[model samples]
Target: MGESVAWVAVDWGTSNVRAWGVSADGGIVASARSEAGMARLTPEAYPAALDLLLTDMAIPAGAPLEVLICGMAGARQGWREAPYLEVPAELGGLALSAVEPLGTRPGLSARIQPGVCHKGVGSEDVMRGEETQLLGLSRLLPGFSGLAVLPGTHCKWAELDGRRLTRFGSAMTGEVFEALAQHTVLRHSLAGDVVESEREAGFDDGVEAALARPERLLSSLFRVRTGALLSGKSPSWCRGFLSGLLIGTEIAGFRNWGGDEEVPLIGSTALCALYGRGLAAIGRKSRIVDATDCTLAGLRAARELL
Candidate 1:
């Protein structure tokens, strides 16, 4: 089969961008990834950046090539503000709320998918690209209804009621770990990364401890330094313990808000594995789903709606 035909799917984020030339039958024909994400581009430069990324794709010259974009590209400060659709939002109907950005050349027809939001009585929360992944999960599983744990700098736990997002919450577990490891006194005690290879390096112990007493998290965090200063703990062990403590705390907190026993874990494989470990320690299990697969599938679902 020659490289040619129909539309595109672009997942644009703060640090990187990925574009896929999709065929009519929902297969990817050509793809490209670049560092020209929302952080690097000005409003007027979006069209040019997209054009540059699609340079090698064999889209025929004539009618404008359709491009569906998601993520930070739809942020208020992005190319054009694709307003947030308030939850309970319909995953299948996301395409109906797309917005078009300005300065598009005649050769391209681009639209941005709006993010999802939740407005409580006083506090409010929002999500950008993850909604597509939720839609993809729904599409991929046909009728999946459970708690989805999307691990990231800001971990999101979303409740999917069939194809609609009923409610969700975020936990700054990763960010908190970073801050504790880098800015706090724990810096001297912990390793630069989380537990990756070893098994019994203090991770499970920390998880169990935190699960039992999440209310003592602030004090528990400081104990990392004390463990190194007094008992001569290894930095690697301290890191694993700290990682597990934070993740386990996150899981414990989610339990308060509510969660399912069999959770759908999304995003980075390594991070999800860490979360899976924490969940397992608390009698819950998780199935990891690659974020890329969900993104592509979601774009297809949106394209179908369009």
Candidate 2:
């Protein structure tokens, strides 16, 4: 057998699958991806899709694949079912049982990291794969203890106590936004692109409107469509207005839940900016970090245990 030269790291989500070939020191050597996301696969089809990717990449047949995966790939419908680790647990200490691929080729082995569950006052939330990034962030910013916001289909507001994820709350913000923008009556009242100036103005207005009466969020949201139809408000501006309203509602909810005084937002640049803008309008402070970096760092951290 030839000497091992690469490691495989995967970030498998609902709609897409991303794989990276990394050097022993963690530099990405090459990468390949496919549409074989959890959303599009059946339990019986996952192993074949994974094998195709690895084989196409020419990953050595017996190099001890050294796989570390995260995201919905570990969920009930993905490769294998991994349980959730409850809160107040050391991120690095969590583990998942070894997962052996069916119809395995020579020398292929894998492991899937489990998700996390946090139970707090009046709230219970869960996350898969994100915990690794949080662990990576904690490692990068040692002694960092504050709120970390990860925005996606299900946005997570995690309370970090050192390298441990103590508690967190989940909001179906992105999914809700997508559904309202495309599948509902609200779609007819919004424009394609939202401008920066309008986003800022709308965001401020939204923060004020939401904070004035948090319970009236859904009713206030309908006003976007009503105002556009009845008063001839520009659809583009109304789109931005709707964006602001949703963000504003999130900010208000977080504020009510406490912990905004010293929170740092972590996600893609665009998402971080939007969240930061909305929070700033509410007179709260926030810092943004690159989501990709954290994911890579987290993948590397997970490999260490192997």
Candidate 3:
């Protein structure tokens, strides 16, 4: 059996759901993951899906379990919508205004934390899961103040003034890469994954190309095919080049948001490492934070508010 639970923490996203059983002092007791994410379930199906996740956990029967959740589960189309908290707002207040859905399990007291939104002059963006990571950022770097980036399907760049999330922006880097690689003519050149040994060289070339002429991105992508067909470039190299080109452009675009030569990147090791390399390309460095640890810490931090 797992360690006796104090509360449960969940990060439910579009494609997967991860839950952790936590001790009172913020230690993890148990953890589980499932493919039953928001995209696969209706509003009425969330509790059952969540129940299936918890079926094997070690929790006392008939005792209330405080389940704190973050991510797409709180989106407008998820189980129940938790309206976003506007930016320039305090991250600590996330749990205070959390929404509790009616008809959850008899012994489950579930609260879904709201996402953050930035409605500034010409910049409008919203984030769900990343806000929790930002909340956990406080514990990782106390009194931290600078730029923080989370790379994923839609990469986010957020600025923190001490503990408050000031302003943020999103880049559709991963999504765009998927579209270009799978649905467009660029597919021919990107048919295979980048070989580990070849990635660095191809990626560096793409970064340099994009940095030199960011405006010519559309035309440059065409070269991926032409280079493969004419110059006989390999599919692996072409894939790496395309990835680097997209990510490099994203970094170049967001560098002015005060990267300050060092940024905090929190996400999967693979993605964060890629972003770290991209940051290095632009003469900036980054610190990586494991997404799971941040989510647990953020959930614990939020629970304290109750």
lDDT of each: 0.85, 0.75, 0.85
- By how many angstroms RMSD does model 2 differ from the true structure? 2.6
Candidate 1 lDDT (Cα, whole model)?
0.85
Clashes of each: 0, 0, 0
Which residue segments of model 1 deviate by more than 4 Å?
1-3, 56-63, 191-200, 256-261
TM-score of each: 0.93, 0.90, 0.95
How many backbone collisions does model 3 have? 0
Off by over 4 Å in 2: 1-4, 95-103, 119-122, 192-194, 256-262
User: Which lDDT tens digits does candidate 3 get at residues 232-270?
Assistant: 888877887898889988888877887464688898898
Query: For residues 193-221, could you state the per-residue lDDT of candidate 2 as single tens digits?
Result: 66667656665676678777778988988
Local error of candidate 3 at residue 8 (angstroms): 0.6
Model 3 lDDT-worst window of ten:
53-62
Please tell me which predicted candidate would have the highest TM-score against the true structure.
Answer: 3
Error of 3 at 87 (Å): 0.8
Better of 2 and 3 by lDDT: 3
User: Model 1 — which ten-residue stretch has the worst lDDT?
Assistant: 191-200
